[model samples]
Target: MFLGKVVGSVWATQKEVGMEHLKLLLVQPIHADGTDAGTQVICADRIGAGQGETVIVSRGSSARILISKDSPVDAVVVGIVDSFEYCKE
Candidate 1:
């Protein structure tokens, strides 16, 4: 898993059979210090995360199995971070 910020939402007019109940968000990967680390990614959200919220993301097969066995999801929002203290050393 990794840290990220929910930058936006992805809306699809039509979705796959098991995906209709999920919401997608555009997440910008962030470092532990909360700075952008890489390109944005569309992530499956099941915990109602919103824009600008700090979130924890899990990727690949582990994430896919959590949502569905046959989902095409490569990334998913696992948690909404409540708060954190960054101590840069």
Candidate 2:
């Protein structure tokens, strides 16, 4: 799994029939401190995450399993992180 933020959205009216109902999102990878890491990817949203929300992504076959144990998804947004606390030095 990878940590990321929902930067934008994606729409595909002509996608595989099995994948038609899934929502797609553009996710930017983020560091532990919540800073952008210069990497971004488009993933299928299994959990209704909105723009600017920090999320957890699962890639490869595992991503598909996140939606349905019997279905297939190359990448998926599984969780939305609510908060992160860092201890000061």
Candidate 3:
């Protein structure tokens, strides 16, 4: 799992049958301190995460399981973050 912000959205009129019902989002990975960590990733959203909202992303097999084991998703927005606090050392 990782922290990220929804940067954009994806629209696909033609997609696999298993993917048709999912909302795809472009997410920018963020560090615990709220800094950009890496390149953006496309994630399937089932929790209604909107653009600019902070979300929790799950990758790999776990992500695929969110929808189903047969789902074609490699990343998924598992949760919408309400708040975050980082403790500096």
Q: In terms of TM-score, which candidate is stronger, 2 or 3?
A: 3
Clashes of each: 0, 1, 0
Clashing pairs in 2: 64-73
lDDT of 3 by residue, 1-89 (tens): 99999999999999886998988999999999889999999999988999899999999999998788998899999999999889999
Q: Model 3, stretches more than 4 Å misplaced?
A: none
Question: lDDT of each model, Cα atoms only?
Answer: 0.94, 0.85, 0.94
TM-scores, each model vs. reference: 0.94, 0.83, 0.96
User: What's the TM for model 2?
Assistant: 0.83
- What is every candidate's alpha-carbon RMSD to the true fold? 0.9, 2.1, 0.7
Candidate 2 C-alpha lDDT tens digits along 46-82:
6799998999898887887766666656789889998
* lDDT tens digits by residue: candidate 1, 1-89: 99999999999979987898889999999998888899999999989999999999999999999999999888999999999888888
How many clashes does the backbone of model 3 have?
A: 0
Off by over 4 Å in 2: 68-72, 87-89
Candidate ranking (TM-score, best to worst): 3, 1, 2
